[model samples]
Target: MAQPNAQDDFAKLSADLSTLRSDVAKLTETLAAIAKSEGGAAADAITGRLRYGAARAEAAASGLAEEGYAALQDAKARAQALGGDLGATIERNPYGSVLAALGVGFLFGLLSRGR
Candidate 1:
């Protein structure tokens, strides 16, 4: 007996909410179509802006990668041009290399130990 009034209120609220959601969906679709049409300088300006943004992003990414590769190549060239056989240098600098190797090996050992 007491449930009917509460149930009626809940039903009305649900219907109102449902109608509002449908109206918003229709508005979104209408705006999307409008933006697609009406081509002119305004449209061209938008297209140009989008293209410029995409090109700038692409250029930045490529420039960063090229800079990194160039730095690596320069470092390799410097090592080769230092006027000593790399193998002989390693042999002469065995103590330093061995210490570095041991440190690296310890790190790898710890990482693998967890697995």
Candidate 2:
């Protein structure tokens, strides 16, 4: 067979290089597609966790609000009962109540004098 020509070898090399460039382009596109898919999945997982945390926090806040309201109602009832008792005592002994009030005021004044 005749020896291979330099022009023929050059043409073969150019064709091989073109095919390699096309393959590299295809590979880059495939890698980009895979990365996008993975990123989307990660985003979904993070969003799900955030929603779950928010729901838990809302429930805890609602529970705390209910407890605070119940405590306030209890305190109000006790205050009303004490007010009724004090009113009855004062009506039965008006002069004694006035004397006790003056004594308590004097003591309070003495205690707070330093402050």
Candidate 3:
């Protein structure tokens, strides 16, 4: 379950990244068109501003991607650790684990009644 959720999260992240890349490409093309269609100092100034804005946006996107990658790594590590711990606990007390599972299921059933 954890693996499936992680995969889904990665899939969503990949889709979002692709969308961001496409948007950046479109913005770059638009800026280029504007710079080409106009002339003189005003056009130069606009191009400079657009370039600066694009650079900042690219940097921000890069930072966000790095952060997301780090978070995903952390989540994967935590999930692995949790799975190990749960396995150890169940191995140490199979009957306890079974009882706990049953209790949890019973509680869920009670809470979910008529839903």
Best by TM-score: 2
| Cα-based lDDT at residue 93, candidate 2 | 100
Model 3 accuracy (lDDT, Cα)? 0.95
Error of model 1, residue 84, in angstroms: 6.0
Candidate 1 off by > 4 Å: 1-39, 78-86, 89-115
True-vs-predicted CA distance for residue 91, candidate 3, Å:
0.3
Tens digit of lDDT per residue, candidate 3, span 13-39? Answer: 999999999999999999988877765
Give all TM-scores, in the order shown. 0.36, 0.87, 0.65
- Which prediction has the highest lDDT against the true structure? 2
lDDT of 2 by residue, 2-115 (tens): 999999999999999999999999999999999999999999999999999999999999999999999999999999999999999999999999999999999999999985
lDDT of 3 at 37: 71
Give the better candidate number (2 or 3) by lDDT.
2
Q: Between prediction 1 and prediction 3, which has the larger lDDT? A: 3
Report model 1's TM-score to 2 decimal places.
Answer: 0.36
lDDT of each: 0.88, 0.99, 0.95
- Clash pairs (backbone) in predicted model 1: none
Q: Clashing pairs in model 2?
A: none
